[model samples]
Target: MLTALKLTAFGVVDESTLELGPGLTALTGETGAGKTMIVSGLGHLLGARADAGIVRRGAPRAVVEGRWEVGDGIAGRVREFGGDVDDGELVTLRQVSAQGRSRAVVGGAGVPVSTLADLVGEFATIHGQSGQIRLSNPDRQRELLDEHARPAELARYRADFAERRAAAHELAELESEAMARAREADMLRFGLDEIAAVDPLPGEDDALAAEQAKLMDLDELRELAAAAHEALSGNENDYDAMGVVGLTGTARKSMTRLSDRDEAAAPLTARATELAMLAADLAADVAGYIDDLVADPLRLEAVSGRRAALATLTRKYGATVDEVLAWAASGAARLAELDGSDSRIFELRDRIAGLDSSLAADAAAISAARHRAAGELAAAVKTELAALAMPHAELRFDVSDAQLGPHGADRIELLFSANPGSEPAPLGKVASGGELSRVRLALEVVLATGGEGHTFVFDEVDAGVGGAVGLEIGRRLQRLAEKSQVIVVTHLAQVAAFADAHFVVAKASDGQVTTSGVRSLTHDERAAELARMMGGESDSDSGLSHARDLLARAGRG
Candidate 1:
């Protein structure tokens, strides 16, 4: 519940502090006395959008602060933002600079403005003139009925409805693009067939290239090997000409004779013996190479042809054999999906059909609930109307069959008849302004039943109403306040007479500036204010008499 509200440099309100408490509190004033500014300030404190124009003409910024007696839920949320809550109390502040910059603070810690908006709904509900206008909308009527009737069931129905709609849309799109998808499938299949015909293995392209290179240089390779072996050993057919083996053997004999005279020559003899054995091996290898060397042009041609086939795949698919293989794998997966689209279309049709059948049943069930709840809600509103000085008014929640939609398969309309013998018609066409005000109030009172220990603020709820209707509106607000805190901004003295706490917003001018301030009224002061609100001078003897009579009638004289 809101405990207090303070406004500084806001609108015509230069500085004002309104101390509030439980039960009905009324703020009343003359026209343009800034009664609505209080509600506007309250809105700012609850994270409404900022407007630099709301700042007083000479002030740089406008500030609004509210103190609340909160619960552990709100306290825990405040702590989540590293804020402190003293006992059960929390303070919220909003500031708007003349440059349109805004800031919000909750429990002394800075927070996003939306944070206050999210948390405010847990403790307060504000109804303003816009709410009255919204009541005439049929969609808003259906929403209100659903909120009161079966919120959980309707939520489930809406979820299924959304899923069914999505599936239907997907099915339609798939059917519409059937030709395009077929073309895509054909292109993919051609690619896949070309790849399959090549039957290229991973790394096969590189292996073929290496084998082809070796085959292309076969003659040169054989010649190079023969020459290298010859350099290491002379021709074996000319052994008498003394190849390296014969020469090294002769040198070893000389070194062996020298080693007999000197030990240092022994190492030279071992090296010469190793050189002679290597020379003998090399001469045998060179003779084998001369015998093994042969040219086969047919094998080389076949190798080159295979390399060309693999090259074709590499050019079309990837830069390498491995990459081409990867493309084939990826294309196969994509082709599978493309080929499966027809089956998926069938699956979607079945899915959408199943969901539609289920949603039909759900919508029927929701309509049934609305019908049942309609009777209860109408009866409740009728009772509230009777208390609000409309003893003969009839309000009906007309639920009729309609096409299935997000809300349900029922059309909800609020029908009203202000006279006893009149037939009820749609509320928008049949209700007068005053009747609408009373009816709107009645619905609010009925729907607001379970909001105990919370705060309800009403701005201009008594608009287009006066006399006994105003009195009854005041009475109902008082009754509502019995369970929850109620605050009303009104021009009706009859309504102001019923408040447990009354504050008068008065505008004053010092020749150059106009400012509004709110002051709590004493019993005597309340009478004077009420008299002034009743269109009579405060000091008039007759007005004072009537004001006192009104207060006494409210049991507060």
Candidate 2:
């Protein structure tokens, strides 16, 4: 519930402090009497966008502040906004500078405008003549019906719907994955075929290259080996002294003859003979080795073909036979896994189908709940309308299936039939401004009794209404005050007649400077004001008497 409101240099208001109570409080003045400015002030306090031009002329800034008795969710939200609040004593202040910068404060701490907006939103909702006209939007109409429904059933329906949506999303991604892997499966098969045909053994390509080199230069290699062997071993040459063993024998005999006088010649001769014998043995082995070096083209061609196949595999997979084999092993394993994935996907799809079917049932159940709630809502609104003097008007909630949204599967629209047999259209289409005001009044009446918000304020709900209809609007507003706080800004005397509290806004100036201020009008004062609204001059006997009579009839005893 709101405790107080203060405005300074805001719109047409120069300085005003309105002390409000728990019941319905009404504001009434003539057109251009700044009644709308009071609504704008409340909006500003609730974190609406501000323009510096709204400040009174020659004023530096516009200010609007409000104090609330936090109830229900408001206290929690106030603390969330960094205000330590107990029992809903929250002070929200907003100031807009002429330079276009605006500031907001909660509990004396400067805070962001959004913070204040969030806190105030928990306490009240401002349904303006333009934005967020409660009955004008289809979605809000649906939400109202849902709020009035069975809470446990709505919760179950919401949970089922969420599961259905999650399953649907998962099914979509799984199907996409299957398609992507199909391409991969083909590529893997192709690679495996190309590699399997090669049948490469590790290091086989290098071994083949060495074997081919040996076969290609077989004759040249054999010739070089034979020459080297011949140089090392020769049987015919230098056996004794130079030609063979005979020459070495002659040298040894000579050396032996000299050995009688000097022994060095005999040792030299024996060593020379041993070296000549080794050369002859090597020459014989060389002749044998040359015979084995003959070329075999058939074996050579086989080696070349084997090497080519290994090389192909190396180029396709990796630089070596081992790498190609590793790639084949991995690709085969993954392809097996991918093939098995299709079964799992099918299982998920089946499960998702089951959930989807269940979700529709759950949604239908929720829709059924709404239908029951809508009937109750219609009855309640009709009761409110009777109190509002539109006894013939019938309000109905048309509950039907709409597009699946975050909320649920049902769409509820508020329909009205002002007369019999006329097809009931939506609330916005059939109701006039005066009728709309009363309709809004009836809605507030219902929501108030339900204990929705801490405070409810109606601006210009008397737009096109007067007389008994206007008085009934006032009476209903006053009745709503019994539950929660209510505020109304109007020009209708009948509405003004039922105010638990009355405020009058008048433009006053001392020549050069002009300003607007508000004060609560007393009972005698209210009569004069009501009479003035009853089409009589202020202070006239007829006007004063009528104002008194109107209050008396409203049963303000």
lDDT of 1 at 170: 86
Write one digit per residue (lDDT tens) for candidate 2, span 1-557.
Answer: 78889998888788899898787788887768788888888888778887888878888898988888776456665566576665558788999998868999887778898888877766676655763266679877877777677545566656766776786786677687887889999999999998887777777777888889999999889879865754554334545324333444455667657766777676765676565565456555776778778789999999998888887878888788888899999999989988977876787778777866766677777778888888887898898888777778898898777875556677778888887787888888888877777777677677657664467878877777777787777777777778777888878888887888898888777897767788899888888888887889979988887788888878752
Model 1, runs deviating above 4 Å: 14-16, 44-52, 55-64, 73-86, 90-118, 221-298, 339-347, 508-515, 539-542
Cα lDDT tens digits for candidate 1, 30-140:
889999999998887667789999999979999999999999989999999988899999999899999999999999999888987787767888888888888889998
- Candidate 2 lands at a TM-score of 0.65
Model 1: clashing residue pairs? none
How much does each candidate deviate from the true structure in C-alpha RMSD? 4.6, 10.8
Which model scores highest in TM-score? 1
Once model 1 is optimally superposed onto the true structure by TM-score, how far is the C-alpha of residue 424 displaced, in angstroms? 2.5
Worst 10 residues of 2 by lDDT: 240-249
Clashes, model 1: 0
Best model per lDDT: 1
For each candidate, what TM-score against the reference? 0.82, 0.65
lDDT for position 139 in model 1: 96
lDDT of 2 at 131: 33
As a TM-score, model 1 comes out at 0.82
Q: After superposition, how far is residue 164 of candidate 1 from its true place, in Å?
A: 1.7
